[model samples]
Target: MVGSCSVRFPINLEYLHRTHPHVTTYEPEMFPGLHYRMVVPKVTFAIFKSGKVIITGAKNKMDIDNAFNQVYPILKSSIKITEIL
Candidate 1:
């Protein structure tokens, strides 16, 4: 059973938009958050300017945890720490 989880983490959406141009799509007029899809975990999430991430298609805590572990580094490197604060 896979359950989706919503995580509120700080990030710089602008940097992410520029970094992963192909993987992410941002259209503020249509949606508030930027859409991102993870391949290995096969999970989808919405990354907002406010730094709230809504992760979906997670099988369990282990899966979610693993996804986060992998995803966090990407986000961290893409965005500046100060920008998020």
Candidate 2:
């Protein structure tokens, strides 16, 4: 199954890549989003700088939910806070 969602917040892709090099694959020259692999649920996520997430390889909705739940916190922590006046 493939599912997609948006956190509706900007994500710091570079920071996320720097922090989590093991599970993330980022090649800006080739792709815009980061490819993140999860072990337990066995899903892959295409995480974009715009906070858009595409979940792939999930067998069911439960697995998709699980993957989203697991990744939410990490994405929250990686939010790119900006100043706009």
Candidate 2 matches the true fold with a TM-score of: 0.92
lDDT of each: 0.71, 0.89
lDDT of 2 by residue, 13-58 (tens): 8877888999999999999999999998999999998989999999
RMSD of each: 3.1, 2.4
What tens-digit string does per-residue lDDT give for candidate 1 at 1-85?
Answer: 3444444456676677778887788888899888888887877778776667777887777776787788777776745554545
- In model 2, which residue pairs have backbone atoms overlapping below 3 Å? none
What residue runs in model 1 are displaced by over 4 Å at the alpha carbon? Answer: 1-10, 81-85
Winning candidate number (TM-score): 2
Residue 3 of model 2: what lDDT? 99
Off by over 4 Å in 2: 80-85
